[model samples]
Target chain A: AQSVTQLDSQVPVFEEAPVELRCNYSSSVSVYLFWYVQYPNQGLQLLLKYLSGSTLVKGINGFEAEFNKSQTSFHLRKPSVHISDTAEYFCAVSVLLRRFGAGTRLTVKP
Target chain B: DVKVTQSSRYLVKRTGEKVFLECVQDMDHENMFWYRQDPGLGLRLIYFSYDVKMKEKGDIPEGYSVSREKKERFSLILESASTNQTSMYLCASSFFFGAIPGSGPEAFFGQGTRLTVV
Candidate 1:
């Protein structure tokens, strides 16, 4: 069985600032990583995915994540964030099924 | 564009009532899933169906059951709804491309149904 851990429950950042949401997984074998975002009163949307190959994966809205095999971490990062980036972010690991973390709520203040 | 649609956006039900949450996907996907989202729990999978008439229990499947008679529809049933089950229910669908070991399919999610049980 595999599990995902998201260290931060909430992150508050000012507008135009950089942000990083930490994600770690426990799996003995190889794993696929993903980042999903959910806006207020909306469903989850795919932020990005790391299937294979390059560790650095770029996603929609200027967001990206790095997959580190040695540390078993896939952290999402953004150079600059806006007020519209305020939402719930989830980190998931896919083996046979997808397992998600507790999620991190990012609040971008104006 | 892939579209996974839930029957209702919001629902209010009473405890011990039999509740059914309907999900439909238009892309003819081979995989469908049911999940419950809580404040601090993210999205927990309740049930998933890989093909027609084949269902699998997910991480949290204690009080839930699912039906997939048709290929495009997957229904989640709560035989006896409880207050603890009042949460956002989501439906998702994905294509099955015979994934290699450790690689899974990307999912498409619906808008979700907010179920409130009193």
Candidate 2:
């Protein structure tokens, strides 16, 4: 079974500031990684995915994540954030079944 | 646009009553999942189906049962609702016909149903 761990439970940042949300996973074999975001009162949307090749994967809303094999990490980063970026973010790992992290709540303050 | 739709946005049910939550997908996905979401726990998979009438237990499937009569429809049932079971329920679908277990396909999620047991 595969599992994900989101290091941070909550993150606060000022608008236009850079931020990073840390994630790590445990698996014996190769796995796929993903980041998803959910706004208040809405469903989750895919932010980005790391299937294979190119450690750096980019997604919508100016979000990107780096897949580090040795470290077992897939951390999400944004050079600059907007108020709209405030949402709950999740990291997931898949082997045969996909498992999600505890989730990180990002609050972008104006 | 591709979509996953849940039957309800919000629901209120009495404890010990049977509850049913429905979901439908139009993207012709081969996999459907039921998840329970709590504030700090993120999403915990309750059950999943890879095909019609094919179901698998997930991480947290102790209190739930599922049915998938048709390819596009998946339903989650709570035999006896409890206070602890009151939480946001999510449905998702993904395409996994020819792909490896964890290699291909991304899941699309429904808007979610907030079920409260009183």
Candidate 3:
């Protein structure tokens, strides 16, 4: 079985400021990592994924995440955020099945 | 673009009523999943199907059942609707792992149905 942990429950940032949402996972076998974003009243959309090879993965909306095998972490980051970027972010791990973290609510303020 | 569609954006039902939530994917994927989302709980999987007529119970399947008689469509059933079951229901589909050779395991999600049980 695989599981994900998102350290922060909520994060608030001013417009154009940088932010990072931390995530970690536990699994006995190798697994794929993913980040998903959900806008208000909408379903989740894939932000990015890390299958193999590269440890750094870039996603939509100027977001990127780094896969650290040693640390068992996949942290999402963005150099700058817009007000429209306010949403809920989830980190997930998948072997044959995928398990999602609790979620990090990003609130971008003016 | 991949499209996953849910039958309703919002629904209201009385307690003890049987409820059905329908989901369809146009991508012809081999994997489909049903999940419920709530504040602080993220997304908890109810069920998933890897093939036509095949189903698997996920982490939280106690209050729900599922049906997948055909490809591209999966249905989640609440045998007896209750206030505790009121939440956002999401449907997702993806190509089976390595099914498309080089495709990744990324699932496409629907618009979600917000079901309120009274």
- Per-prediction DockQ scores? 0.61, 0.64, 0.55
Candidate 3 contains a number of clashing pairs equal to 0
Native interface contacts retained, candidate 2: 0.69
Each model's total of backbone clashes: 0, 0, 0
User: At residue B71, what lDDT does model 2 achieve?
Assistant: 93
Lowest lDDT 10-residue stretch of candidate 2 chain B: B96-105
lDDT per residue, candidate 3, B1-118, as tens digits?
Answer: 9999999999999999999999999999988999999999989988988889888888899989999999989999999999999999999998887643212478899999999999
RMSD per candidate (Å) reads: 1.5, 1.4, 2.1
Q: TM-score for candidate 1, please give it.
A: 0.97
CA lDDT of each candidate? 0.93, 0.92, 0.92
On residues B58-109, what C-alpha lDDT tens digit does candidate 1 reach at each position? 8899999999999999999999999999999999988875553212468999
In angstroms, how far off is B103's CA in candidate 2? Answer: 7.6
lDDT of 1 by residue, A5-56 (tens): 9999999999999999999999998888999999999899999999999999
**How accurate locally is residue A75 in candidate 2, as Cα lDDT from 0 to 100?**
99
Tell me the chain A TM-score of model 2.
0.98
Single out the weakest 10-residue window by summed lDDT for candidate 3 chain B.
B96-105
Across A19-89, the per-residue lDDT of candidate 3 in tens digits comes to 99999999988889999999999999999999999999999989999999999999999999999999999
Clashing pairs in 3: none
Task: Give the total clashing residue pairs for model 1.
Answer: 0
